[model samples]
Every structure is written in C-alpha cells, then in structure tokens.
Target: MSQLQDNFGRRFHYLRMSVTDVCNFKCTYCLPDGYRPDGKPKFLDLNEIEHLVSAFSQVGTQKIRITGGEPSLRKDFTDIIRIVKDNDKINTIATTTNGYRLAKHAQEWYDAGLRRINISVDSLDPKMFYQITGENKFDDVMRGVDAALEAGFERVKINAVLLKGLNDKDLPRFLHWIKNTPIDLRFIELMETGLGHDYFKAHHLAGNDIKLQLEQAGWQFDTPAVDDGPAQNFSHQDYQGRIGLIMPYAKNFCASCNRLRVSAKGKLHLCLFTENGVDLRDLLQTPDQQAELIERLHGQLAQKKETHFLHDGITGVTQHLASIGG
Candidate 1:
C-alpha cells in the first residue's frame, strides 16, 4: 500500500463512496421543493464500485464511509457493505443514512460488520420536522432511531443541521433528548450549498455559539473525554450521552481532512467543496491504464484545495450536496 501525505503531513487514509444519487426525502437544507431533473441519475454498478474500492485500498485507504443521495435506497447495499468489510486493509466501515429504512436494516447491517452509523435528523418537533424535510414521517424516523439502538449498534449518532430562525429554538430540546438516549448527538452548521444558499440565508452558527446556548439553557458542558472527528464533543454535567458540534463554515478542518470522496458515477473528488474530480471509471475500462490513473490520483491529492470557499463568493463548480454524495 502507498501512503500520500498532505502539505500538513496528515496521512490520507479515508474514502467516502457515494453508492447512489437517489434519495427519498427532500430536506430543505439539501434539496428544496419544486426541484426536478430532466434526466436519470448516473449510478455505479456493483462491480465497478468494487473495483474502485479495491484500487483505493491498494493505496493505503483504511476507512470507507458509504454515503449517498441516500445509501439505504440502494438495492445491493448489504453486498456493498460486505465487500468493503471483507477487505483486510479496511479498518472501518460506516454509513450515513436518513434513517427512513434503518429500523428494517439495522440488524442486517450490524451482522454484515458495520460498526458506525450517522443519521441525519434536523428537528425533533413534528411540525418543524415536516417543515424541514417536506415529509410528515417524523415518527418513522424516531422509530428508526429506536430500532437502531435495539439492533445493538454500539455507536449511533444523530446529525442535526442547525439553521437560524428555524430549528435553533429546539437546541435545548434536542440536548434533552440526547441526555436520555444512548446515542451521541451532533449539531452541524448550515453550509451555503445546494438549496441552502437560495432558500435559507446562510444563518451559520459557530461551535462557540452552540456551547453558549447549552450553558444558557442550564446545561453544564463537561468534555466527552474522547477525541473524535472535527466535531467538538461534550457531555452534560450529569447527562448519560454526548453532544457534538460540526462547525465547518466557521472552523475549517481542511488541514486535518483525512478523507476523500468518490461520486456514485465513479469520479474521485478530493474535497467536499471542489468541482473538479478524476474520472476513475474510464481508466478502469482499460486494464493497461490503472497505474497511470493511480499516479494521477496522487497528483490530485497534492493539488487538493486547502479549503472550500463556500462563503467567499465562489460559486457554480461543485454540484449540489445531493449530487456530490453529502
């Protein structure tokens, strides 16, 4: 296996694979209403996906996260999980889901060697939930969360996308839920991506703001006592579970970004905010071209932008989060 170090000397070892570009829910933050496409989405076949993962594994990739328009929507999702977990070099296999189908598949996923799961849940209130997701199935998602816990997934995480004047008022209620539930809660800052910029005025919230809100609500912050992702993890002084804040816009983690993303159509993206990507599907069709493709991939990593300028007036290169596999 080959090791590629960034300018900051952080070894890149994680790969995020978007297995599909189809999702069921239309979250206001990601995909707004009245948004339609003229044509079908480009999806990767199982064999092509497996080949790409195998190639990446040969280059020292150890952690692979299965993301999608909604990864759970994929028919061969279990098979995909099995292939990645079967790889001896892959150390972690995780998935970011909408939790719509989690209840039904949680046990199967656990049996297939999946150890981590992140569920995107924006609001806890039923009416606000419908307003955020444009769907009235809040109870279904809650059921899915309970099902995940019942399935014995050791690490279940809830991801909340915070928007000002929206669900921000429910932060305290969200924290209250976290205190009683065993799963970890994460608060994500709204990025100016997809429909976020057009419909929601990037009412960005920083990590410090979240901490302050918790304190004002009478919740004392005690560090979770564990070092994790870019998220700043904390626990209520007497709560059972933990809370995390992902402040991408305010506090950029590009320097410490240890992961790369691959679109469902087989394009290798070096950053979440960049539009340029290396097409690996074309190279895979030509057996004699794998080595050159590998070299080019390494070069892309070297050229990976230091940070994404979402709020810096740069626009129209990176596709919407749905298309880019957020």
Candidate 2:
C-alpha cells in the first residue's frame, strides 16, 4: 500500500469518519439547543463510505476512527464497522461516543470488530455533568463505561474536556476516579471549534496549569503514556491509571498531524481548523471516476494547513465540534 504523505512529509495513516450528524445529548461545548445537522439525511451511504475507506487504505491508512454527532444514533452504525472489519489493511476500528447508547450496543459493536473506545465524561457530579452536557445522563454514561469493561475490552480511556470554571473544579474528582481504575484518563484543552469563541476563550485553561495543579495535589508526573493520537501523557506514583493532556491551544501538535477527517457531509477536512478540502461525495457520485477521485484527494491533502492557529487569530473551518467529528 502506498503511504499518503503530504508536502510537509507527514504520512497519512489514520482516518476519522463521521457516520452521522445526529446526536442525542446536546453538550454545551459541542451541540446545544440551537445546533442543527449540516448534511443530508443519508449523507454517505454504506457503499460510498466503504469505497472511500478503500481508497484511503490503498494510500496507507491503517486505522479508522468512527465518529459522529453520536455514531450510535445511526441504525447502520454496526454495519459500517462490519464493512471496515473486512479490510485486512485496516488494523483498528475505534469510536468516540457520549456513552448514552453504549451500554446496549457495546457487546454488539465489540463483536462487529470495534477495537478502541473513548467515552466522554466531564464530571462525576450529577448536576455539574448535566450543566456541561445539558443532559441528565451521567449515570447512563457510567453504566456504559462499566459495560465496555465487562465486554472484555481493555484500555477503555475516559476523555474529559477541561474548561476554566465549568469542569475545572472537578479536577480532583476526575483524578480520584482515575485512581480507582486501570483505564486511562485524558484532559482535553478547550478548543475554539466555532461553538462559541467567547465561551472557549473564557474557559481555555492552559495544560501547564492543569499539570501543576495535579502535582500540588500530590500526583507525581511520570513518563508519557503510549497512544495513537497527540495527547501528552503522564503518570503518578500513587495512581494505578495514567493521565493525558491534549493541549491543542497552548501547544499545537500539528507538526506530527498525520490524520484527516471526513465530515458526515462527505467533505474532506485536511486540518481541524482549516476550511480547505475537497468534496469527495460529489466526485464519488460520478461514475467511473475512482482514479480521478483519488488524485483529487491527494491534491487536497497536499495543502493541509500548516497549523490550526490556536495561539493566533482563529480563522478557518470554525464549525462546531458536533459537525466536525471530534
């Protein structure tokens, strides 16, 4: 298989496919009361999706992460997994879920060749969790975590999106939960992903501050943890699990950016913050143009944004995270 390398020499090996733009929970950070889907009802059908993945795999993409507004909301979610599972080149099939619908489908998804799972849990406090997510489903997510572990899936990591005063007060609470399990806990810096720039700026907590706070609380910062993505990992002498910080704002990880995202609407997002990309859906719709489509994809990727402009003025694909497939 040919490796899809950009002009910057970064080889593309991972693909983030947003299967559906519909979600159940309306998280304030991602989806809110007024948020709406940007794509058609059936954006990318099963065959179109499989063909795109096949084209990408030929260009050295070994891992595919299925994302969404909430992927489980789609009835064909499991079918998409099964379709990708048949590919010998793609070694991993992962999904980032809110965990509301996971308890019921964890076992089924696991059986359908799902490998990795990252569940989003901001706070342990019921009211605080609801406030952040605008959904009173904390217990359901907890049950989903338990269900993932029980399904014989190991390394079930927890993703906590860190905010200034919203979820920062519960940092110790999150650390305590990490101490109780062997699963990894990751703290993601608030990204200015077109949700509400002002809100993001107000709650943008530097990764260094979070690390310092943990150190002051007696958590020792150890060596980094191993992972596929860009999260900086750490460990504590007293804790069994590991801690990770994804600082896309203060510290940009674009130098090593090797992944590309395809929104549910079928547009290729070369960079999370860049508006440049190709309309793969339209090209694929044309008959007998697979080779043309592949060449066009490479052309778009050759222009992957140098950086997301985290510390600078943010001007790019400023769409909400729900539509962008976080």
Candidate 3:
C-alpha cells in the first residue's frame, strides 16, 4: 500500500473525519453564538463514511479520529464507530467529543470498538467552564470523563484551550485534579480563525508558558505514539496523569505533519488552516469509486502546503474551529 506522502516528504497515517458540523455547545472561542444551520445541511451518511474510510485505509491510514462540532450529537455515532472499527486496515479508532452525551454512551461506544476518547473540558472551574463553553453542563461533562475511564477505554484525554486571563490560571487546579486521575490533560493554543480575529487577539495565550512551568515542576517529556496528534506530552513520576501542550505557533510545528482532515461534507483538508479543501463527496457516493477516491486523495496531497498561514494572520476560509472539526 502506498502511504499518503506529500511533496515535502510528510507521510500521513492519521485521518480526522468530521461526522457532522452541528454542535450543541456555544463555546466562546468557537461557536460563540451557537451553531446556525445553513439551509438543512446534507452531511455524509453511513454509506459514504464507509466508502471514505475504506479508501483511506487502503492508502496506509492506520488511525481514524471521529471528530465533529460534537460528534456524540449524531444519532448514528455508535454505528459510525463500528464502521471505522470494522475496517481491518484501521488499527486505531478514536473520537473527540464535547462530553455532553459521553456518560450515556461511553460503554456503548467502547463495546462498539472505540478505544480512545478525547473530551473538550475548557475549564476546571464550573462557572468558568460555562463562561468558556457557554454551557452549564460542567458536572455532566465531568461525569462523562469518569464514565469513559470506567468503560474501559484504552486512553482518555481532556482538551482545554488556553485562554488569557480565563482558564490560563487554572493550571494548578488542573494539575491537582489529574494527580491521581490517570487522564491526559492537553492544553491547546488558541488559534485565530476567519471569525475569531478579535477574540483570538484578546484571549490567545502561548502554550509554551504552561510548558515552561511544567518543566520547572519536574515533568519530563514523553515520547509520542506513532499516530498521536501534535501534542508535546509530558509525564511526572509522582502523578498518574500526564500533560500535553499543542503549540501550533512554535517553529517547525508542521515538520511532523502526518494527519489529514475530512469535513462532514466530504472536503479533504490538507491543513487545518488551508484556504479551501477538495470535495471528495462525489467519489464517496459508491464503493466502486474507491479507486478513484484513493487516487484523488493522493493527487490532493501533492498540493499540500509546507505549513499553515496562521502565524501570518491568514486563517483561510475557516470561520471557526467547529466548522471543520479543529
């Protein structure tokens, strides 16, 4: 099988597939006003997802991360997990969610073959979480985290976007919470998008600040797994959990690029901040189109840029992170 290699010699092995663009939460950084549908969205159905995953698997894709505005909102989410899990070529099946429905579906998802889970928990403080996510489901979300662990997931991670003067100071609180929790807490840098320029300017905090503090506290860097996301992970000898920092602004951050994204509508995004994506929906309509779909995927990689233009203040067509499952 031919690996998905770009002109820059980056071989892709991970696929982030968005099952839907609809999110129920109104996060201040992402969907501040909430998700507004655009004339009845026509998201990819089960058949298309099966064909899409099959074509990708043929190209040496080893991991598929099911993402969404909140992937758990989809009624067929478990079936989606089963679809990716059923692919013999796929070795890892994971999903990122907002944790709204995790408590209710954690066991069902794990039983369906999901092994890894990532939940968005922007704040440890309940009020602050509500302020950041614009939802009062903090307790519910926390319960879901525990449920994920109890459900026997291989790994469980929590994602928190570092916002200035907001959850930035909650590092100590998070550290204490993770001491015995055995969870991987990841702090993501606030990325500027087409619609969040002012918000980004006001709230963006450097993930390096947290990294520096972690290093000072004796947290040692940990080697990443073969298909791990861009997070620089660190572990402490005394703690059960780990911390990961995702600093997209850091130099050479894209040098290790090995992941590709597919939007709910079947557009293939070579980079998170690309100007636009190539539509694969036409080729995803039938299993017979798998060969052409794989070929188109390879053709698109040839045009993948060396790096995203986020540092240059060019966000491309991404109005917000939720639109394409950031």
Candidate 4:
C-alpha cells in the first residue's frame, strides 16, 4: 500500500470528497449566488464513490471526509458511507454537513461507519444565522449537533467561519457556551475563496490580534495554530471542550498541508485557493485507468502551490465553496 507523497515529500493522509454542490441554504460565503438542486452530480454513483475512496486508500489515504453542499441532502448518503467502509479499511470516515438534515441521519451515519462529523453553525442566534446563511435552519443545526453527540461519534466539530465585523462579537459567548459541552468549537478565519469580492472583503480580523484577545481573556492554547492542522486549539481551566482558531488567512497552513479535495462534479482540486484542477469523473467508468488517475493526482501534488495567494493580494476564484468541500 502506497501513501500519497508529492515531489515536495509531503505525505498526505486525508482527502475531502464533496458529494454534491447543491445545497438548501444560499449562504453568503458558500453559495453566495445560488444553486439548482437539479444540478447535482449523478455522474458518480455510490459504487463509483466507493471505488474512488478505495483507490485513494490504496494510494495511502487513511482518512476520507464525505462532504457536500450538504451531504445529508442525499438520500443515499448512508449507503455511500457503508460502501466506503466496506471497500477500504479507512482509519476514519467523516463527513461535513450544514446540519440541516444531520438530526435525521446522524445515528444512521454512525451505524454506517461514520466516525467523525463537522457541522457548520455560523451563529447561536437564529436571526444571525439567517442574516449570514440566508436561511432559518439554526434550530435544525442545533438539533443536528445534539444528535451527533448522542449518536456517540468520536469527534464532533462545530466549524464557524469568523467574519471580522459580523460574528466576532459572539466569540466569548461561544467560549462560555462550550464549557460543559462535548463540541470542539473552532473559529475558522474568513478565506479569500471563490465566493468572490464581497466575501473576501468581509474578513478583516487578524489572527495575532484575535489570539491576543483570547489569551488576555484567560484562554490557554498549547499548540501552535499553524501546526499539523489549521486550527490552533485552546482550553480553559474548567471547560471540558476546546476552542480553536483556524487562521487560514492570518496563519499559513500550507507547510503542514496534508489534504486534497475532490469537488462534487469529480474535479480534483490540489489547493483551496486555486482554480486549476483535473477532472476525474471521465475516468471513473474506466476502472482500468485507476493507476493513471493516481499518477495524475500525485504528479499535480508535486506542483501544488506551497501557499494560498490570499495573503499575497490575489483574489480567489468563482467556484462555490459548496462545490469544493471548503
């Protein structure tokens, strides 16, 4: 069994696979424009997804993260999970969802071999969630979070994109709320993503200043925010849960980059900030060419841009975040 190693010698262990780009909520960042549910990719079926995951696992991917505009929207999401577990002995089978439908599917997903779950909760207030996400699924998101914990998943992460002037006021509130909960609340920095100019200009928070505020407020973070993963984790003396800062814009996480993403349409994205990618959908029906696809993916990783150009004054692309599993 070979692992995915680039020319730079960075061995990758994880792949985030977006099952579909269509979503219910037209969030300001992810689907800022809009989407058509009928536009979902049917090119790769459950069997094809399983084959893709197995092929990657054979090439050294240990963790496979199922993502979508909302993975739960798929009626066969659990079927995909079951097939993935049966096809490969992946160390972890995880999924990222908007949490609108997680409440109904969390237990089934856990039984189907899903071990970890990441839910997007932009705000604890419904009004704010609606203001940011353009939907009133805040209660649904909370229900999903509670369901995930009750379902006994190994790790339940609450991912909040930190918009500078918009949601920064809720940091202390989130910190206090997580004290006795099991959620790993993480604050993700607003990235200059393909969502376009309006989204890019929304992020004005500096990672250093944010960290300083957290430190002064009495949170103790032991790990460097830029190490291993994007989030620098913090903990309080009494809080059982952990707080995280994913300073993707303020902290360069490229040095420890260990992930590659495949869009719902079957395009392989080597980096989050780049539009350059190769389509793998055309090769799925030709199983004999799995080796060729693997070679193509590995070759591209060698040329993967060391860091995103967001900090270098480069504007992002036009692809939707829901499409890329970002």
Candidate 5:
C-alpha cells in the first residue's frame, strides 16, 4: 500500500469524485444558460467508477465524497454510494447535491451507507432562489432538507455561496432557519470562476464580518474545531447545530489541505483553481497501470499549489466550484 503525497508536502487522504456533469439547474455561479457542449462527453461507467474508488482506497484514501453537476441526477447514485460504503478502507462516504431531488433519494442514499450530505442552497426566498439557481422549487428543497434530517444523515450541510450583491442580504435569514434545524449552515465566499466572474464583481463579506454579525445578533460561537476542508466552523450559543464559513478567496487554507479532486473526465486536480490536472482514467484499465497511477497522484501532491490566484490573468479557466465540487 503506497501512500500518495502532493508537492506541498500534504498527504492525500480524501478524494472528491464528480460522477456526471449533467444538471437541471443552471445556476449563475456554476453553469449559465446558453453554455452548451459540442457533444456529450463520455461518462465513467458504474464499474469504472467503482474500480477507481477501490484502487484509490487501497492507496490510503479513507474518505470519498461524490459530487457532480448534481450527483443525484445520476441513475446509479445509490449503488455508487453502496460500493464506497462497503469498502472496508473508506471510513467516510458523502455526497454533495443541489437538494432538488434529495427528498426522494435521501433515504435510499442513507440505506446505501451514505454518512453525510452537503446540499447547495443559495437562498430561502422563493424569488431570490429562482434568481440565484434558476429554479422555483425552493419549497421542494426545504422538504428535502427535512427528509434528510429524518433519514438519519447526521451531517446535513447547507452550502450557500455568498455572492456580494445577490445573496448577501439573505445570510441572516439563512442563519435563522438553521438555528432551529439540525443542519449545519456553511457560507462560501464566491470565487472568480465559471459564471461567477460574469455577474459577481466583488466577493465581499469576509468571514470575520460574518462572525461579527452573528455576535451582534446575540449569537455566540465557540472556536471552530479543525477539519479536513477550508470551512471554519462554529457552534452558536444555545443553538443545536453549528455554522461554518469557507473563505477560499480571502483566507486560503491550501497549506493544510489534505483533499484532492477527480473531475468528471477523470483528471486529478491538485488545487481547485489549478488550470491543469493529471489524467488517470486510461491508466486505471490495468492493475499495473493502476499502481503507477497512484504513485503519480502521490507525486503530483508534492507539486500542489499553496493557493489559487483567482483574480490572476487566467481567462475563463479559474476553478468553477460546481465543475470541481463544493
């Protein structure tokens, strides 16, 4: 069992795999309207995805997060979760979804051994929700959240990407809803990628500012416990659950980053904002090639960039949160 490490000396232990790029909602920050592909790209077959996960597990991957344009959109998502959960080496199995279809699938996913779920919901207002996500089923998403809570998903995360002029006003409302629920509300700073660059000019609302607002609102939070990702978490005083803030653009957590992402096309991305990625799909066809691929992944880790230059001169290639994973 060889261990994989990145260029920054961070050991790889978590892998976020994107199953499909097809999604129903065309969010302004993710995929915009009129963004069309010339042709359908080849998606990894169920067997191939299982093989990749199994091989990665053997090489020291203990956590596997399934992501997508929306993973629930995949027909075999439940079985995919089961495959990772049944693997003895994988201790954590989770998925990130938009929650549009979670009401129907959350229980099935839980039965298949999914331990956690992260749902991307930008706003609670129906109109604002439609404006942000290009969908009008905000009530359905709320029901999905309720369903997840009932389905025994212990960690139900609500990921809200804070766009300065768009959803910034909705933060307090989001925090209020989460105060009574068991879900963990996570505020993500908008990054300069995908459709975000087209609409969002300033990625304002620093983590400290949010914290101050919560404090002034008579909500006190404990110092966040350390975690694998960049989310700085805090449990509100007298609140049942916690609130988290991921400041990727303002405060980069690249130094302690122990995660790696596999894009839908099978490229291993060392950093979210990295323009290049190492392809591993073809190499997984053979056992010998699989071992070599693992070694290469480990070697690539050492070269992981310390942080991303989102505002840099990279035109239209900045890391899109949805394309990579949230």
Candidate 6:
C-alpha cells in the first residue's frame, strides 16, 4: 500500500473528517453569538463520505475521527458511524461531539461501533459552563457522559479549552472529578483565528502552565500511541483517569504531524491554519473514483508546508474553529 507521506518524511496515519459545519453551542470563544448559516451550507452526504473514507483507507489510513460543529446533530449519525466501521482497513473509529445527544444516543452510537468519543466539556462548574458555552444544559451533558460510560465506552475524553480568567482556575475541580472517574481530561490552549483575535489575546492560556502544575502534582507523561492526537498524555498511579495537554504553540509541534483533515465539503486542509484548502469533492463522487481520489490525495502532500506559521500571527482563512471542525 502507498502510504501518505509528505516532503518532510511525516507519514499520515489518521484522518479527521468533518460531517457538517453547524453547531448548537454558542461558546464564547468559537461562536460567541451563535452558529449563523454561512450562505446555505452544502456538507458531504453519505455516499460521498463512504467513497472518501474508502479511498483514504486504501492509502494506508488507520484511524478516522469524525468531527463537526457537532457531529451528533446529523440525523443519520449512527449510519455514518456504521459507514466507517464497515471499512475493515480502518482499525480505529472515533468522533468528537458536544454531548448534546449522547444521553439518549450514546448507546445507539456505541452499538454502531464507535469505540472512542471526545466530548467537549469546557467547564465542570455548571454556572461557568453556561457562562462559557452560552448554554444551560450542563446537568444534561453530565448525564450524557454517565450514559456513555454505562453504554460500554471504556474511556471517555473531556476536552476543555484553557481560557485565562474564565475556566482556568477550575483545574482543581476537574482534577477532583477525574480522580475516581476514568476520563481523560484534556486541556487545550486557544488558537488565534480570524474571528477570535481579540478574544484569543484576552483569554488564551499557555498549555505548558497546566503541564507544570500536573507535573508538580506527580503526574507523569505517558508514552504516546502511533495514531494518537497531538495531546501529551500524563497519568497518575492513584487516579483512575488521566490528563492530556494539547500545546499547539509548543516548539516543533508540527514535527510529529501524523493526521490530515478534510472538511465536510470535501476540502483537504493541509494544516488547520492554512490559507486555503484543496478541493476533493469532485474526486469523491463515485466508487470508481477511488484510484483518482487516492492519487489526488497523494499529490497534495507536496503542497503541505513544513509547519504552520500560527506563531507569526498568520491564522490563514480560518475565521471560526467550527467552520473546519477544529
């Protein structure tokens, strides 16, 4: 099999595929106001997604992470999971959701072969959660998490974007909750986007600061898996759960790049902060297009830059994280 390798010798093994660009949560960082329709969104359909994933699987892709504004919002979400699960070449199938429908649909989703789930839970405090996400369904989200565990997901991950004055101080609360619960709590540093420039400057917290605190508390770094996300995981002997820190700003961060992202509309993003994405929708139309699709994907690697220039304040064309399933 021809592996997806860039000019820098970085081989891609994971694919982050977005199903839609619509989200319900009005998070202060992402969609502060709310998810406004950006000129009649035309996302990928079931047949398109199947062809795309199959082509990727043929190119040595091992894992597929389905993301979106909120992937579960799709009516055929379970069917989407089944689509990826049907691809025997793909060994790992995961999804990142807002937990809006997990309480009721987690079991159904798990039954469809979704083994790993990453749910966004910015704050453990109900009031702070509402303050950050502009929603009041904190309790319901927590119940959804409980439901996920009951539905047989061994480890559920919670994603929290570390914001300076908002939920930054809530680390202690999160630590306590994860002590007994088998959840991998990940704290991500906010990235500067076209729309969140002012907000990023005011609330962005360094992920390393949280790393320092975790290390001081005796949490040790765990060895990363071959197809793991960029998170640097840490584990404690006494706790049932673990902690992960996603530091996109850290030095040589892109040196270990192993995943590629494709937007809901079939545009391949070389990097999250790239100025433009390569259109792949045309090649994803039919099953017979698999060979051309794989060749197109392989040829795009030459356009992949060594690293993103985010530190230089160049956020590319990304106005909102929700737009590209960040």
The CA lDDT of each predicted structure is 0.77, 0.81, 0.93, 0.77, 0.77, 0.92
TM-score-best of 1 and 4: 4
| Backbone clashes under 3 angstroms, per model | 0, 0, 0, 0, 7, 0
Evaluated against the true structure, the overall lDDT of model 5 is 0.77
Q: What clash pairs does model 4 have?
A: none
How many Å off is the CA of 113 in candidate 6?
Answer: 0.6
lDDT of 6 by residue, 1-326 (tens): 69999999999999999999899999999999899997988899999999999998988799999999899888988999999999999999999988989999989989999999998999999999999999998999999999988898856999999999999999999999999999999999999999988999999999999999999999999999999999999999999999999999999999999999999888999899865898999988888888888889999998899999889999999999988889
- The superposed Cα distance between candidate 1 and the true structure at residue 124, in angstroms, equals 0.8
- For each candidate in turn, give its C-alpha RMSD to the true structure in angstroms: 2.7, 2.4, 0.7, 2.4, 2.3, 0.8
83-164: candidate 2 lDDT, tens digit per residue: 8999898988899999989899999999999988899998889998999888899999999999998887756889998888
Q: Rank order by TM-score, top first?
A: 3, 6, 2, 4, 5, 1
Residue 177's C-alpha lDDT in candidate 5?
83
The whole-model C-alpha lDDT of candidate 6 against the native structure comes to 0.92
After superposing candidate 6 on the true structure, give the runs of residues whose Cα lies further than 4 Å from its correct spot: none
* Number of clashes found in candidate 3: 0
The most accurate candidate by lDDT is 3
lDDT of 4 at 92: 82
Residues 88-156, candidate 1: write the lDDT tens digits. Answer: 888888889988998888999989988888998889999999888888889988888898888888789
- Alpha-carbon error at 288 in model 2, in Å? 5.5
lDDT of 1 at 305: 71
Root-mean-square deviation of candidate 4 = 2.4
Global lDDT of model 4: 0.77
Determine the backbone clash count of candidate 2: 0
What's the TM for model 3?
Answer: 0.99
- Off by more than 4 A, model 4: 36-43, 222-228, 316-318
What TM-score quantifies how close candidate 5 is to the native fold? 0.91
Error of 3 at 215 (Å): 0.6
